[model samples]
Target: MIAALLQGCGRGETPVHVSQFDAFGIRIDMQLLGAPEQLATEVAEQTAQDFALTSYSLGLEQPGPMQRVNELLATTEPFAAPPALLPLLEQTRDLSERSGYLFNPAVGMLTDLWRPDPVTGKCSEPPDDESIARLVEAAPTLDDISLNGIELLSDNPAVKLDFGAVIRAYAADIAVANMRARGIRGAMIRIGSDLRLMGDRTGQPWRVPVLRGSGGAVLGTLDLRGDMSVVTVGRFQSPCFRNGKEYSRIIDPRTGYPAQGTQVVTVLNSGDAVTAAAAATALFAAGPQQWGQIARQMGISAALLIDDTGHIHLSPAMERHLQIIDRNAQVSVSPAWQDSGPQ
Candidate 1:
């Protein structure tokens, strides 16, 4: 169990108290603002338990329906139709087709191979290239897995659905929904580094500091006062080896490899943490070129991209929300940045 406590005054009322806990590796931080002490305690305890059950994959001891489907895709021979796996299967299939197979064979295969080891807490590497090549040759198409709520199997079943790219975002969305249902406003939910913000902090923007180092020093800050969901993805907070090899926990579903290049990317969505989370991870994996196209396609409100060179690129929408505070050196937004327009 990992835990941290935050205490600060808000609205000149009693100090706001927030306690974050990670049980079974489902990260959650609960903030009590202007609430009764007893009620806050109860809410925190209950919320923690709820998040642990629904969001923590490791906590799901027995294979739930989802896990069962995942297992089926892993082991059993291909069937005609798998009813339980329909939703995920359909989503995977659609994404595969739309992404022009850029996301299909690679992503799922890699996830299956390098998923974090439960005991070691480290991600394993993919099988040899020859093995991957053979698997790719025998990969199943999206159409192959689309069964219309029925069970189906194929003789060549090399492909599988690895929703690791989207699961954290999904969990964030679930947490936001649950919080809203309970009438909790003016709060932020952070699962690992993914986050969702609801309401304002006493009419002021909620300032979330982005840390570049693992020690949590401020790299920058985002002002999320409105009802927006913000998700950040990067290699910053992940573990690093002394040999100069940095491995991000985020895996690119396409090639079964850890996402590389660029330091960080933050995606802001108006109301969907899940979408924001997915976009952040996907954009990071896709890199800047693909990310720009996606930003235009998705109409993302704002974005911040930091690369290995320490160059910062801010989307047009992000300028309004940025206030740089580099006391030691001059850090300027790039001229090519859309934000640096005529004004």
Candidate 2:
């Protein structure tokens, strides 16, 4: 996971307030600058509580709102979508469409096929090809799910919902907004490998580590300022290994199998973290050959991809932001992605 090495103290050397807490099934590290210690602590507590509520609402394994929604989806009947979940689903569906469904969250059954052992974090046996093919043929997608106002329903029974891919970024966006609302000017939220930055860091840009892969050595650092998101997707995210081959947690919705060909892909966006996170996943699934095209479709300008062969590919925009450390590392800069709009 990437860590924001908070450089320097708070403004005028006031000392930044740092807090660490576990929520949404991951550890969240928050650093707030230009705020009183008491105020920062209160904001952190409130943000943690908000994350708890989001977890309860969106969690599928637990007996909560999302579970109930999934149960109701099985019957193919219209029901009122939970207030907390409706907007998120709407946003995710739009993102899915933008990525040509490459970033689908409706393949919960497909995801469950590759679920890892909680303690071992690995699947002892790889899912058989037949099981994967069945779900792929069923073709469950966010398109099958419909929303009208607060009412929601699914025409396809195979379409199950899982927001694990984007919720952390979504939560971080909310936290950052709440922090800004409270008059705090500078802060950063590091949720897993994804980071959301607000304002500046003691009048300087935020420096965040960019790993080669999940838990892999640091490839370089990205200097970011203002409101932006840096999201990385890699094989170490829920990987399953059987024998010697590794299976990534990022599943190709069309193939119902773990995506391959790309070791890691990180996208930086001056937009909401949710879109940035989804683009990273889609680009990873798109593999090295098609990442640039899919990234263009998703309106992502800055992205870096490390292919399976260890070659580093950078978009023109990304090349400007990242400072590569290894002078001998193979690097190629792609042309700027012109906005042709979504196809």
Best prediction by TM-score? 2
* Segments in model 2 whose C-alpha atoms lie over 4 Å from true places: 1-12, 335-343
**Which has the greatest lDDT?**
2
> Tens digit of lDDT per residue, candidate 1, span 112-161?
55445666666455457776556556655555553533765533456455
The TM-score obtained by model 2 is 0.92
RMSD of each: 4.9, 3.4
Q: C-alpha displacement of 327 in model 2, angstroms?
A: 2.3
What is the Cα-based lDDT of residue 134 in candidate 1? 62
RMSD of candidate 1 to true structure, Å: 4.9
lDDT tens readout by residue for model 2, 113-139: 888875666586888999999999998
